[model samples]
Target: MAFDWSVEQIAAAPSITPPTLHKHYFRERKPRAEVRFRVEAKLFTVLMTETEARNVSTIDKYVKHFERHDACVPKSA
Candidate 1:
């Protein structure tokens, strides 16, 4: 599954800042339960509306995948 939403867009739906989402994306820190729930809720809503399919498990899979990946740092030129 793929989403066209950017970090900013995803964060906007949950009222989270882009930097916070970036931190999560890069595995800088684990997201708090409240933040994680909000993001999951947003994803659930969008996926249900767009595909008319229930995808909570799929969302969880991707979230866990990111958390398990090696930490990333932004590259500088």
Candidate 2:
């Protein structure tokens, strides 16, 4: 979904410093695994609170896009 949160708000949710998030996540640097998890968790929390069908779909799209090229780390055998 199109979030109403500003960069400051988004950064706040994941406990990331605004400047770091802007330079990393917003500026196209791939976030570290921990940062990615926190951000995705925040988005998932938002998705859980959404009730509209269309908005849920939109949020799903955002999650997928965020996860692009970043598969789950494989378990050690």
Highest TM-score: give the candidate number.
2
lDDT of 2 by residue, 1-77 (tens): 02224567878887998898877776444445555676778877777667344576777776787565344434340
lDDT of 1 by residue, 1-77 (tens): 01324567778977999888777656533444445566668865766665556566776676665555324312330
Off by over 4 Å in 2: 1-31, 51-54, 71-77
Model 1 misplacement above 4 A = 1-31, 53-77
| Residue 38 lDDT (model 1) | 68
Count of clashing residue pairs in every prediction: 0, 2
Candidate 1 local lDDT, residue 46: 66
Candidate 2's error at 1, in angstroms?
A: 22
Compute each candidate's TM-score over C-alphas: 0.30, 0.38
lDDT for every model? 0.58, 0.62
